[model samples]
Structure formats: C-alpha cells, structure tokens
Target: MKPRICYTVWFSQRNRSTLLCEGLTATGIAGKPAELLELPPATSLLDFYQVNDYAALQAKLWQQRMTENGVFGMKANAPRKESDPIIGQLAKLSGLKVAAPTPYAVWENAFPNGKHIFLTRRNKIRQAVSWWKAIVTGQWHLEKGGERKVDSQVISQHYNFEAIKHLLLEISLRESKIQAFLEEGNIVPLTVVYEDFVKQYQQSIRSVIDFLGITDTQYPIKEPHYERLADELSDQWVERFRIQLQKDWKNVIW
Candidate 1:
C-alpha cells in the first residue's frame, strides 16, 4: 500500500518541529520524511539537474516509505524567499509545460492524501525576535551538550528594529497565506503551538501520533536532543520590539 503522508507546514524557521519529528521517528512506524528537496547535496531520486523523467522521480520518492501501515512525515519551511523554491523545483521537473504551480498545488501533487500539521507560535513578537537573534549571532541551532551551529567566529549580536520588523511582518504574512490555503482546500490540520509543545513535549508528540492514527502509542516518546536557544537577550529583544512597534499605527500584525 502507498505510505500515509503527514505534511507539516512550519510557520517560520524556529517552530521546533525537530522535536516533533524526533518523537515520530523514534516510534519506528513513521518513515523519515526529511527535506529531500533542500539544496546542497541532492537526494538520490531527485538529481534534478540531470534527471529528465519527473514522473519516475516522483514515483521513487512515493515508494520510499511504502509499507503495511507506515506514515511518511515531511515539513516545509516558511515561504520567505522571493519565490517558492519547491514550486520552482516541481515546475522544472514537469518541464514547465503546465500552468505555474501554487504552493498548495505542489503539496497536493506530492501527496494526494496527505494530512497536514500546522506549526505556529501565538506570540508573533517573540517568534520574530527569535529568528532575528539567530541571524545576528550566527547560531542557528543549539545541541543539548552545549554545542552550537555557528560561524567560524562568533558575530557580536545587536538589536535591529528594522530586521525584527521585517521578520515580524513576514511571519504574519506567512501565517495568513497558510491559513488561506488550508481553508480553501477544506483541510483541518493539527495545530501545534511552539510555546505549548515545548512545555508539554510528550503530550504534544502523543497528539501527533494520535492524529496520524499510529497504533504504537505504548512506545516511549523521544524528546528533542537539542536545547532551547532562548536566553535573557532573547527576552529583552521581545520586550524592546513590542515597545518600538508602538510607533507603527498598523498594529494589526502585532
């Protein structure tokens, strides 16, 4: 049978879906649903620059997790770039003969029966500041052992109101687009709040397993091996951003 698909729509960069992904894969009932489309080293089935048969490529990807009752979980980051690269990749794969694709169209095409999970944060200000901090510090993620994914030399961090403002609006726009797409498609996704998921790690994971209808609930859940990157500086930025945002009368995004 074709593998059941679980598509996670990440609101922004720091949605902490890695923890959720870890919990799902630890069950061994869900196949690895990583970003095979991301650039750098291409996944085997998608040697996009050379491969000509788009149909066969899609077929190979679909068959990767096929099993009796296995679920394939994949996540897509926010569409903050100038163009939706996923759609671009798919268009190239299709030889550009058809109509240009929308984000939801590409998702639906990949997994016709895919179930969606919406990863969001209630505090948009904090979420935006968290993203800005990572950019300034050059530390994208932190490991539990205190290791950091950082640059060769640590960049001195600073608070830039414009940068945070741009990110805040981008996040707002992303949430709006995602909700509109799901509503248009009549899809109800499992909404996982970043704030709540971090606090109720096990419960959130169980909820996802339940959403996917996985029967392996008795297995022990796995927590994220990474640590929360937020600190006193992050909190300060959150407060500063909210205060600075007062000048803008279009406070709907805040």
Candidate 2:
C-alpha cells in the first residue's frame, strides 16, 4: 500500500524549520515531516539520487521517517531557480517523466493531495547572514543546550561581504519564485513567520495544529529542540551589509 503524505512544508535557508518541525512532531498528529529526500552536502544534483530513484526514497521513508499512523509529512527547500540542483535531484529520483523543474512538477506523484506550508523569515538580511555563516562554518543548526559558539577560524578571516550579498540575492529570488509557483498553482499555503513563531511558540504550534485540522489531543509542549545561532557577530554582519548596500546603491535603506 502507498503511504499517505499529509503535507509538504516548503522553505529556504535560515527559516528555523528544524525547531518548527520539532514542535510539529511534538503535536503527534502532524506526523514526522522530515527532509527525507534532501540533496547531500558537497554533491551536485545530477550526481546523486539517480541510481536509487523514487522507490528507494519511499522505502527509506517507510523504514525510517514515516509514522505508524499512516500520516506522512515532508519538507523541501524551495528551488532557487528552475536550474536549481534540487529540481534535478527530484526529477531523477522521481522516476517519473516530469519535464518541468519545479518541485511540484517533479514530485507530482508524491506531492499531490498533500497540503502546503510556506515558511519565511521577515528579516532578509539576517536570514542571508545566517545562511552564509552556516555555509562557512559547516554548522547549520545547533541542538538544544548546545553552546552558541562560532568556529575560531571562521570569525577571523572567513567573513566575505560579497558572498553574503550573493546569498541574499539568491534567498530573495527563490522567495519570489516560490510565491509565483504557489500563486500559479492557486495553492494557498499556511504561511508561518519565523520571528513571530519564536516569540510565541506555543501559540504558533497551535496555529499549525489548527491548519492541519487535527482533532487529536496534542502532546505536552516542550522547550524548542534547536537553539538559534544569531549573535553579536550576526548583528555586525547585518549592519555591515546594510552599510555596503547604502554605499553601493541609492535610497535602499531609507
């Protein structure tokens, strides 16, 4: 029997999805929505997921990530562009003859009949800074009770202004493209804001529960599983990025 997929939460970098997915899993009714089909680090899309194909992905999920209740949830980072590696990853593994590059098209076999959730961060510069920091440090998320420390080598000389700026553009462009995809598909996703969710986590989880329309009693809410990485250095980069933006462009920050 085919496993039922309840929804696919779409996002990009630095949206704090790890924490939110933890919260949602705690709810028990949402099932465990894990990034089961993600592209591996340091591997290009064309180079991976081809041999195993889509059946392998499902088998992997059923054996590991899928819940016993027959409710499955998944998450995917929105493609930065049509040419994004993720599209190729999905298309090849999908084992379907999907010509389009968007995830919705490639995962049509797995995506349809599932709801959509779009997560976004309100602060673009901060998100970009976080993305670049993680890329440089090779530490995307910190587990709960983990020390919020940046690598010593990274802070001294790894701060590249242009790299962060380029990431900011990538983040922004991908967001625009995702919005269009949702609009074109007439898909209304439950949009969650990172800052607001962090401020009122319990309430935010409740909102997600309500969106899922589940009547089961939720498990006791607990402290978030992941810690935020934003620090003084993060702030410093944000301000520096803004200053550079002002110096290079006109009326951008006013």
Candidate 3:
C-alpha cells in the first residue's frame, strides 16, 4: 500500500484554509480527498465520540483512505481541548502523517512526529481589520453555523487590537520555537507566507508535495476572487493597525 499522507490545517477563522485544502486536493497525488473534520460544539473529550456519531465520521475517513489517486488532507479549526486523543487515534488507525500551519500549540505537540507548515499572512493590518468587522457584524458567529456564540467580551479579551498584535507576536514566537525544536534534528518543517501562497499557489503546493515525498503532475492554480466593499475607514484603520504589525514583523524571522 502507498504511504497515506494525513494533513491538518491549523488556522484561525478566515485564514484561507478552505482554499489551501482545495489546492491540496487538486494535486491528486495520494488518493485522499480533502475534507473538514470539525468537532461537535460543546462536547468534551469524554463524550466526543458519542456526541459526534463516530460511525459516520469514520465512514468519511474510510472513503478518503480508499482513494487511489492522490493524497488526502483534512481541514479543521483548532481542535477542542478534549479531542486530542481522537485525532491521535485516527492518525494511528489510518497510517496518516499530520500537517498543520497554524500557531496552535496543542496540535503542534500532538503531531510531534508529523510535518508542520507555518503559514503567515503578509498583511496583518488588513487581517485584524477584517476580523474586527467580522465580530461586530456577527459574521464570525455565522460561520460556525450559529451553533457557537460569539461573546463580545471574549472577543475583546482574545482578539482586541492589542490582543491581535499579541497573536501575531505569538505566531512569530512559535515559528522560532518550531525552528529550535527542529534544530535538535527531530522534525524539519516548512514555512510559507500567505502572500506567496496566493501569488504562487502551484509552487507552494509543489513544496508541500515534495516535503511529503510525493511525485505528481502539476495542477493549474486557480486564483480566488476576493472583493472588498467600498469603505472609508480601510486606509485609516489599516494605518492604525500597521504600527503594531510593523513591530511584530521586526520580531519575525521569516
């Protein structure tokens, strides 16, 4: 049997994760189709399988596993605190190696033997501004299918302007930590910038393919359409946020 490649996308909300998964699926190397593996809301690890109906989830996993043409990748938001064992077990059962590019420390630790891909967005100011708008307008809550509530205080606590700056800083710090961990010569991970990933999707995918030791024909990269509404505050908003991002950038190694 060919080696099964298991991938997990580690990203905060609205980080172009869906597009990345599409790019991975387009490669058609591993026989696995990319799918989202979301955990059920308000479920603890003890009752995760019971609440999630593992039978259906396992069926999807089997379908992806049975693919004969290309690699299989899955996208998910940050795993719940309790679902770690489930992820680990699924990885073992499927013989899949994990891949994540987010800054979540838990997934990083969970897949210690797996490859880590750190993806950083180029325009932090824009990202923060977008996040801010999403929260105020309840766009963030809507994406989770309205099952999860978006607490303004929690948002303020976790993602306020200052908090966003720290989040960027945390991303930078994790990059360093991953590098240092690799320096011990355990796991060598790949890093990609979001700007480069968008502009050169094929190349980015190629890097991922090569890292996984897969040889496949190139796939045409499709550009995603993104439109910004005509708003007066974009420039000023970005300018205000840019100061913090610039400071964070100085600390970022790559």
Global lDDT of each candidate: 0.69, 0.73, 0.50
C-alpha lDDT (0 to 100) for residue 230 of candidate 3: 15
lDDT of 1 by residue, 1-254 (tens): 44565555454667786667766667677655555555554443356434557777666656554333556666666554547555556554442334866666666766656787888988888888889888887776787888656532343257889999998898888887778777756888889999899999888878877887777657667657779888777787787778777856665445
lDDT of 2 by residue, 6-115 (tens): 67778888998888888887766677877865656877533453434556655554445455665567777765565765555556654466465455666555454567
State, as a TM-score between 0 and 1, how close model 2 is to the true structure. 0.80
Off by over 4 Å in 3: 1-3, 30-37, 44-66, 76-114, 138-185, 218-220, 225-232, 242-254
Which prediction has the highest TM-score against the true structure? 2
Off by over 4 Å in 1: 40-50, 63-68, 78-85, 88-106, 147-157, 247-254
Candidate 2 Cα outliers beyond 4 Å, as residue runs: 1-5, 40-64, 80-106, 151-157, 248-252
The positional error of residue 164 in candidate 1, measured at the CA in angstroms, is 0.4
Q: Using lDDT as the measure, name the better of candidate 1 and candidate 2.
A: 2
What would the per-residue lDDT of candidate 3 be over residues 27-69, giving only the tens digit for each residue? 5563333434554765533354343544444554535533464
